[model samples]
Target: MSSLRSSELDGDSDDSQLAAKFWEVKLPDVVPLDDLKAIEKTQAAEVIQRAWFSHMDKIIFQLLKHTICAAENCVTHEILKKVCPSEAALVKDPSVQCKVRFRFGGKNFPPFIVFKIFLHTGGHGNKYFSGKNTLRPSSEAVVDACKLMGNRKYYDQIIQDQLQFQKYKVADEVDVVTMKDYMHFTSFLDETPAYLGGKSNCWRRLSLENFPKTMIMYDIMDYATSGTLSDRLQKELKYLLQKPKSKEMHHDQLRIVSQVRHWG
Candidate 1:
């Protein structure tokens, strides 16, 4: 009888905890700008400045959240569940499906993009945003920083993986046999979020012997969006697809490849 009573109590406790976890909990929100330090109402561009700073804070929080998640052992889906389990309901909603299709251009984009963006921007330090020579800075410096904030390590890894994938293609000589590993490589990206450290070393082993054209296309498409060798790839694919392609395309491909090589 004691054991039965203990089991009933444990069941009730579990149900209570689950209920608590399902609801929203509030915490105190901090204000970075104190009353005295706040922007003056008469100051030039005061409202615009406030709005801009507010947006910056939002971006910073977003970057911080992704960074913390990336450093965690949990999978991307698990992270989503912890953050907002209520979103689970959307899985069965037709409107949610329609939105997903629209957002990904009629197809789903693998979650890797989100992972990549988070990892890229979560990088520590101000290397991406140093002012140009101090006085009278150029807009280019700021833009370059913003671009770097999302285009460094993620780009490099994708490019290296693509090169390895292409090497297998060239070695096999036959389009069919040379690209077998392509599916596994691209599927890895499509299956797991990049921030989860899902791009494993095994990805390098993908070769023409294991994959097909559909898989090759998937790999190419993902690499193309990675912005690593995108410009060179865009030009190369265009040239190879074009009949009597332009010399400019050839030159640009060479230029882009050379630039990346130098960067390495």
Candidate 2:
């Protein structure tokens, strides 16, 4: 069995059940909120749950993509590397300026992580040029090749300037981040809805006021650039433990042949 480490951050002071959950991902260590609290509160005891709820509701107010993405970048003639997509910016200020690519299979697996573009390569922005896991044989080859080919333009523009490169990686190797962190994920507690993916959007909100893990698309891109995938290895996702707490092995997928064991 995989032993849980202090790194799991399970909100438990004692060690009993594992902390690092399949549905729970450790977000990149970003700056925590400075003297920030949930905008509102409930009549319940001053518990963390109530605090989280109040914070989430307020944060989602400014999180409407329609308000930010649609208005700012379009009017300012400036691509704010913050909230992107929906005809908005790509990456604003990323830790890794280069877009990291991983190979799992076909087109469904495009460059999984696209690093945000920093306005300048200085301070925290320098991770693209320097960092652990940033050092790779393929990346060096690309740089040298561009130099030898006399393609200083593509090299300088994309590689040096944009800090963009598509390195070969895998899901199990590097981090597999969603566009945002949906904190409302309830795996052990809520199983049926988990597979349904019905309230996925509802569960995922860009509310960081209370839940710092809640990220907008822009925030995610920033981490993609600066973050390195953990070397920690595990079983293939398709073979991992699933809900209803299964012990016996079963077919990977369902079809005709076998009669339903747990039918709704």
Candidate 3:
């Protein structure tokens, strides 16, 4: 009876070990391949999102510091270098001049910030300085500005005021008889231009309304030069302008005119 009991106990032990080995082999097979892939993709996306947020946070911090310096009227070369080291380095050349403009609110307007960089050759009415300048507080900057202001309503009011101001300024500069005529001349056609499609028009109109006219013009010119614009559009504009060099000039002129249009 004792021998029989020992043999039975050994048999039970062997069964338990086999069961453990079977489960170990089947565990991986039980998890779906799709689930494993999904887990990997999620992990990758999380890593990318974390990197993007970290980058944006640094930009916001720098913008906030620059704003504070501007508000205090203590923005200097040293401060600018600290705030934007890369831009400062670019402007270190003697030919480049940097100007910082700030607008604080009164009863009519809210605060705004602008940075302009242009070529300075110590001459009057030079072609280089005409429209060859960098203007900042871009659309991205505007979003950052809204964040800094802590009030979207005020920022919206500020944008409206800026739109009005730009219109009046253009009219006064060009001696336009009325804003109505200006808008009529720049009006969107009933059909999209052959060079641009419906999708391009949609985005262009949205950009025109939301961003500064000069910046939009610069971007458009860049697109045209970089071949980002449609081949047909480039060919047509080049033919009409008669000179490839004049494309930028024409765009700049249009920019001034379009600034007055009430798209938004």
Candidate 4:
């Protein structure tokens, strides 16, 4: 009788946990700035600034969340059954490149696969803005955890029991493969806000203030309204894509590739 009672209690406990998990992963209401304030006094421009920052907070969170998950192991296989599942979604990294060259053996060996490797660092989630009421610097813990991960060894034993690699035997005359790694450094200062970290609507306080945010967004579109940089990009693309023997516009195609602006 005791064993049967324990089994019944376990089933009820599991159901309660499942219900809690479902509610945890459910979506929070999206904020619409215009709806929050009447457009009578506030211009659409400032309204949009708030909206953009709010939505950006969501995007930045996803980009960094997985990195935190891997770095801190904050979410365990067990918590996965209880915590917010949006936090547990699988992330795919396209770091290793594989090229296979087949070898013949009437019945035997596997083909040689050449691998080109790259390393990736990921960003944490919107939890950075979590505990808004507690005055905690948002997602700061996760961000610190992610940055620390970069300083650590990202890979485990090269030939551990679960994973291994064999050398790709290049053809007799081919050059040997070389491995290289590259890293870039960036410096960011000060605490960040939950939304629009440094962006401001200070102009909203002035009389007769007006903002044309839509026109501004439209004007920022590449090439068409993007102004001076557009001219340079056209020249660079023309130069790089030029036909080998075509001789016209030699001046246009001769400009330095580095001089072109990379951003769209």
Worst 10 residues of 3 by lDDT: 197-206
* lDDT values, one for every candidate: 0.38, 0.29, 0.42, 0.31
Better of 1 and 3 by lDDT: 3
Off by over 4 Å in 3: 1-29, 74-264
Q: Please report the TM-score between candidate 2 and the true structure.
A: 0.16
Residue-by-residue lDDT tens digits, candidate 1, 1-264 = 999999999999999999999895887776566643554544647778989967644533332233223223223233334334454344334444311110112233222222211212234422211131121325666456557656775466446546644654421112333345545534443343334223321211112222122222222333433423344334445433333267665444333222322211
Compose the digit string of candidate 4's lDDT tens values, residues 1-264: 999999999999999999998888767797688766765446787888889966644433332222222222321222222232332232221342212111112232211111111123343222222221223334676456446655342222212212311221321112234331111000010112223221121111101011111211111122222232334434444334444364434322332321223344
Across 1-264, the per-residue lDDT of candidate 2 in tens digits comes to 234654454536434444445457778776445522332343234577878866643433222221233222222112222323431233332443432111112233111311122234445532212222343446976567466657755444335322211331211113334432222222211222222222111112222121112212233222233332212101122222232133223222111111122222
TM-score against native, each model: 0.17, 0.16, 0.22, 0.14
Steric clash pairs (candidate 4): 61-125, 64-123, 64-124, 65-123, 65-124, 65-125, 128-138, 128-139
Q: In model 2, where do residues sit more than 4 Å from their true spots?
A: 1-43, 47-58, 61-67, 71-73, 79-264
Count of steric clashes across candidates, in order = 8, 5, 0, 8
> What lDDT, from 0 to 1, does candidate 4 have?
0.31
**Ranking 3 against 4 by lDDT, winner:** 3
Order of candidate numbers by lDDT, starting with the best: 3, 1, 4, 2
Give Cα distance to truth, residue 19, candidate 3, Å: 12
Reference-based TM-score, model 4 = 0.14
